[model samples]
Target: MLETPYVAVDVDVLDRNLAGMAAVARERGLGLRPHAKTHKCLEIARRQVEHGATGLTVATVSEAEVFAGGGFDDLFIAYPIWPSPGRAERLRALAGRVALRVGVDSAESAEALSAAVGPLDVLVEIDSGHHRSGVRPADAVRVAEAAERAGHRVRGIFTFPGHGYAPGQQHTAALDEAAALSAADLGDGVRSGGSTPTAPLAEGGALTEIRPGVYVFGDAQQVELGGCGWDDVALTVVATVVSRTGNRVIVDAGSKVLGADRLAWATGFGRLPEHPDARIVALSEHHATIEFPAEPPARGDVLRIAPNHVCATVNLADELVVVRGGAEADRWRVAARGANT
Candidate 1:
């Protein structure tokens, strides 16, 4: 058996996830730019491309450079980046190598990126109720106009419906995304809409592209949001029980391995795929305390714990063991693990 506190990927389920999202995008007449931040593995990124992803979406210039170096040519930095001199130079080099695009939320960003990268393709970021990095939808046109005047090409608009992560808010977030993109209107450019939560609601009306990261590896948060089934989870931390109490078992995998990203609405720190009722009530540096409904498992017993955020968990691991049909297939490195520039 592999060592405890390591991330494992079931290739069968991973393939299922890849194809399912590809089919959804195709049926909806939308382009699939599956976000690479989730897995950050070159092997998974290759599979996504083979499964019909038009391009890859990354969060930072460094991540884009990593994927570009791996020969995944087409890429978009979905986050609204404030490019420092070093990052700008990197972006320039990456743009020279691949078909690169980035998200812009303000006139200053538009002007600065153009000056830095020399007339790159930029998509204005709309808020769409996320209230994060993006600007108001009604203000997207001004940004687009500023982009064009600044010597950059305004491709269209994109929004991250992050609020969809909450239970029963998927549809509303999707609708808000559509409405925001529609209101942003920069002629007939590619309108990008996000997130795994609202991906299923894409109906070909507003969005031309969908970027969903977590769908490739279902998580506890996805489970709680009704976005994916427990069986659909492709990645999990394989942990070994280290201590046993009356009704609780402490596992070797904890916040350090599984990531400490417990959503406010999340039931627990993590979830047990085998025992649905089990709750990972607490997590220490290298231990996860799970409260099981029944008798706690014996020490040394191995359990798979699905994390609340697959992206963060993936970022923490150095490599993910790939398994197929219940046997070890290969191991993939997290190539973009610290590409957080």
Candidate 2:
């Protein structure tokens, strides 16, 4: 057995998740360019490519570099990043190395990125519902036109159904995303939108592509939002119970290992799959306080914790311990971990 406080990926579950998403994309006639910001593992990315991903979507330039170094030829930086001088240099390098695409939510971002990385492909970001980034669907043409003026190739518009990660909101969020993209007249460009919760409903009419990241490792947020069941959770943190007091116990895995990204809808910081009623009440840098049922596991017992946010949790780990046949099978490095530019 590998040491506790380590991140583990159930190979069977991971493969099932990948196949499930790929099947949906194939059936919908939608392009599958899964976000690499979730697993950040070359092994997982390769598996996704084998399962029919057309390209990889990443959040940062460094992540693109890591995956590009791993031989992934096509990449999309799916964030409206304001390129600094250093980031501009890196983006220029990445542009030369791969089929690079990026998101542009404003004319300023479009112009800046175009000047930094000449002739790169740009996707106008439309604010479907999340109100995070992205221009309004009605204003997508302005951003696309600006990108064109900057001498960049406009690949069309995309939206993220970020609001879909809530109870009974996936369908509505997906519809909103579709409506936004339909309203944006991009003219034969790639209209993309989808989150893990809304991907199952993605269709061909409005979107030509779907870029979801957390499907490979369903998290507590996905579970509560009904995106996936506990059984679908592929990645978890393996922690050893160190101290116990009645129904509450301390585990070796904490915020540093499991990530501290509990959503408002989440019951706790994380979930204990074996003890469904248990809640991770608190987390220190290296310790997790879990409150379980009457019959709590004893000290020194190893437990698997499904985190609230799999993407952030994966970014915290250096490697993932692959589990097979209920045992550790291999160690896969999180090669893109800390690759935040």
TM-score of each: 0.99, 0.98
Model 1 stretches astray by more than 4 angstroms:
none
Task: Name the candidate that leads on lDDT.
Answer: 1
- Over 92-177, each residue of candidate 1 has an lDDT whose tens digit, in order, gives 89888999999999999988887876789899999999899898988988899999999998888999999898989999999999
Among all windows of 10 consecutive residues in model 1, the one with the lowest summed lDDT is 110-119
Clashing pairs in 1: none
Candidate of highest TM-score: 1
lDDT of each: 0.92, 0.91
For residues 75-114, write the lDDT of model 2, one tens digit per residue: 9999998888999988999898899999889999888887
